[model samples]
Target: MTEKNKTTNNGTSRRDFLKSASMAAAGFMIVPRHVLGGRGFIAPSDMLNVAGIGAGGKGQSDIAAFAKSGKANIAYLCDVDDRRAAASRASFPKAKYIKDWRDLLEKEHKNFDAVSVSTPDHNHAIIAYHAMQLGKHVYVQKPLTHDIWEARLLTEAAKKFKVVTQMGNQGASNDGTRLMAEWYDADLIGDVHTVYCWTNRPVWPQGIQWPTNKSEVPKELDWDLWQGTAPRKEYVDKLVPFNWRGWWDYGTGALGDMGCHLVEAPFRVLGIQYVKDVQASVGSVYVDEFKKGVFPESCPPSSHITLTFPKTNKTKGDVTLHWMDGGIQPERPDELGPSEPWGGEEGNGTLFIGTKGKMFASTYSDAATLLPKERTKDAKAPQKYKRVPGGANGHYAQWVEACIAGYGKMEVSSPFEVAGPLTEALLMANLAVRGHDLKGGALKYTWDNKAMKVTNFDAVNKYVKREYPAGFELKA
Candidate 1:
């Protein structure tokens, strides 16, 4: 457990709030462009002035990468929760802290050259969208957004804004992921078919849960602001700090948590254009007392959902991809081979079965290898595709370099071009869950990438884009 420990790189532990305040007070005066970062001088032109819109867990991780470059000026830190905002200010004393992202956009839009949107899945589009419109380069974290429409809008908006863009699946640029794809392209295994990817999360339900806000609202939390794009609800303590990932209103269930990292490799190397058709079934097998108060009736306490994507005729033949989550697994994943157990307590890692052999990988798309053991060494595959490059300066560093360089080159493996579609497809899984849950029926739809809309299923179609809270429009 990486509980917050109060210590700096120099090993001086923060003994009291007083000591923290005193030390930070001195830090607040220094120009972050120079003093806070301890690296050799970089040309002012090379420094990327960056503002972070969400500075909780992942948000701070992105900031750390930028701070590491010693070439970043953390011009501003923004969070909807006052507690988060205060903690971030204490964490990066050099950064100016703000409450509402809109205030930063309206007043300090030009203060930073690039902005990192690390909010939850639902808000990703709003923050990143508005930032790009202000002409700032943007990086929004993965499961790009909470819904399919948001994903499409983001991809198109980035192109329209012409800003350097990256999704927070940092593994996209890692050496391991590159090797994973290269191995498949090498035909170390024959044509791949069927993928079994799973994660153990969303211990809660999707959609909304209600009356759970009975717990006192923390003085530091701005419940209304935290509900930025989500439907407003009373304050609930358990939902804050953590446990927000399982709710549909704020998150995209299991797919949102692990999809970008797990589903990406198979989609990329295979060059899958679209799922063509998708379906999901969600059911609750646990809970006795009213699971209300924390979550709305629309959500289940725990759910097992399966997603299937039928290969289009354009895909040449049929390729069925299966997703398992909520701590469930196939009876015998071993038929695939010796494997690692996942899904928290009970889930299987991703499986890819090919006509000639099989391959399995952990969540990050690293640890990828062939099946049937001997087929790996004897395999013959074309060696023509140019080798992809490994990530150099961490996630934020790459984006920062692009911001300063004025043009960001594609990293290939997990660039927005690939991550965007994968994210949209996965988000659709959330809609499928809602469809199945509401009517005990399946969701059927057609996707037009050009138009970015579902041809049928209006109920789920309404889900493509959710209503944002007032004044949070993401405009181009």
Candidate 2:
């Protein structure tokens, strides 16, 4: 057999198939599928080969979801911690395993058509950006990047590379969000001027000091790789696996963890883009009778941030969005009965206040409802948009199929184009949260979207674009 058509023990080689497929698309002679295989057989070229980075926790589930599509091959797996990667390694035994993502991309880029990045918030932008530069499609976890600048960079890169891109906010594809959009379109709720998104998060510890006691790195973990873009620091106990969500160096606090999922509903329904200004009030922890504990390295225990957005084609005037976390919630709307749930059964949800009526939805934008409880019974709106086959769960397959179909060939629910601004808005809210402490008082920060900085307070602008360690610097 010719080298290009060489087969592995089972069948055609993925790398060779990809090469041949590219040539065919470039005007080379096409081979008939039946001639190459039986009538009912599917070609290897039809399947998307995916390389998974951060192959544990959310990463593990993401890989499995893509595999569940039955149209993806988990061709490679890379993780900083072997212990964490164990399950995925056992699940996809054929996928080559590596300790560092940089090495995997360097040595095996030819074998995969896409990359799934579920790494910590700090590392998301760098890994995904590099993969896109190599002309591979990317699926990144939500709160797209750690900083506003990074989010904008990835968005531009997606278009520049002409590669399929998706952010891991599965709710963007859920039926509830689409229904809300349809309802708004039908004027079931008139122009929504105000929105409230709340969640009980920081389930991980926050508003505390970083542990000073250094701990030996686990044998199964690569400490350096885990700290990818963040400043170098000693390894601390219990920081890995989950608790990183509470730290500023590694996580975006509660807003980063849940903002994408909760705020997405109003962002879509109102067609809002970047925020024009943001103000925040944070709950402080008292160390004793005289002093409040100051843990600048950690996120506050609670915060209520307000972001105002300029008017869009869908609204008559500017929109105001309220984001509350750390167990804070908006006042219960009087339209509902006293015993009725406030946000949703879970206490995490989004509420929309409009001129004519109101609407709300649970976390992930699921189970949408109208106000007054009774209004929901007969609410009607035309389903103007197409729904994914399996709703939110279908997010993975949607990206996989879109990658196989090539960029611009298919539509994904949360492409970088839509996700970028959404993420920036959340990060903008965070800027205010952090600024509240930096200013030592409550203050509103005006945003210059074009300049990508805080126009009023220059101190908070430092976070608009963060400084990275030498090796991890993000370059244009």
Candidate 3:
């Protein structure tokens, strides 16, 4: 038995089968891994060699998880900040380390079979797109890309490149998500028409002006590489590892931070597609004497955005999903005792309203409960969906295994086909948030998903596709 087949435990090696299958099915020569010395090469052992693009924080933990999957070898680690890269470097001591992903992919693409992108939101698309272009599978952090256009581009690129892809929304693989689906399929929650996904995120800063005083760029950091795709700006204090989540240039605000995790369950259970329209109401920050302030560059202090999705196989009509963030939450349903704790300990949760009854789940779709609590106690439904092994934490292994099996050969929970539109929905809601300041506070924005524009508000369309800085075009 080949070493790869031993790990697969299915008697047939994935790559071996994919190689022969490609030739037989295509009836033509499909370049084998051995020929891709300038791209990604599959090892003779069948182990997938992976490169970590932002090897710190979530990136660091992601590599560790991939390494834990036993199917992946962490071959290369790259990050703009050496300080952030330290732990991953220590853990994967044998892996080569680089400071720039562009250099790593350009110089060492041949050594790796896949790339895991866990960079700041603004940089996710550029890195993931390039990796896919090189025929490397990618696992990108949510929300998929910084802007709407990037998400659409990466989604198409995934199909065009024919490489395996997964988003970093681990909850998509959780048992709770499947449980919800089983219940919905069984009519336990009959045709959910509304979903409320809320979070207390922005544990980082938002709704504030950019730091006026530029700080010294850390000696351990490469500011230029970290600023990839976004227009370059002077370095500021403490924005490196986490605070970037709150800035428009660096992050996509709370919706971007938690939307993928919170929204994935509803999107899956209800079979949500691209959003049809959106409207938002955001909390204002006090600026100073006698004025409310709108810091356009930073995410608002809090927001309640309602998104409308076209009906799908699961819904009778349109589906409305409400997203609340920044410590805001929806009214507790009567199903639970007044004293019972809600969604996350941090007051986050997701609720689905259907014709028969309502159901709720905790953050990341954990711990689902039917309305009235008693229904949850008496709930019974055939498990229609197979649980991903290891649930939420299993997401890493799921992607690793899929990459080995080859693209289109395995079912990953949050592939680009799924993550891209999910991301577009969140970014669409953000359009309402950002455009609230424009057109004398327009209350609603009707989206043309086919056109990827706002039909009602022409001014907000500029954000549909942002201009990449010089030398940072989305290329083939």
The top-ranked prediction according to lDDT is 2
Cα lDDT of all candidates, in order? Answer: 0.64, 0.86, 0.84
lDDT of 2 by residue, 322-416 (tens): 99998898988879777877666666999999988898999888888888768878988888999998999999999999988889999999999
The digit string of per-residue lDDT tens for model 3 on 130-205 reads 7777788999998999889889999998998899999999999999888888889889878788889999887998
Across 115-222, the per-residue lDDT of candidate 1 in tens digits comes to: 888887778877777676667778888888887777777777777767788888866665545565666766565566676777665566444545433787677766
Q: What is the lDDT, from 0 to 100, of the residue 393 in candidate 2?
A: 96
Q: At residue 417, what lDDT does model 3 achieve? A: 93
TM-score on alpha carbons, each prediction:
0.80, 0.91, 0.91
> In candidate 3, how many clashes are counted?
1
Task: Using lDDT as the measure, name the better of candidate 1 and candidate 3.
Answer: 3
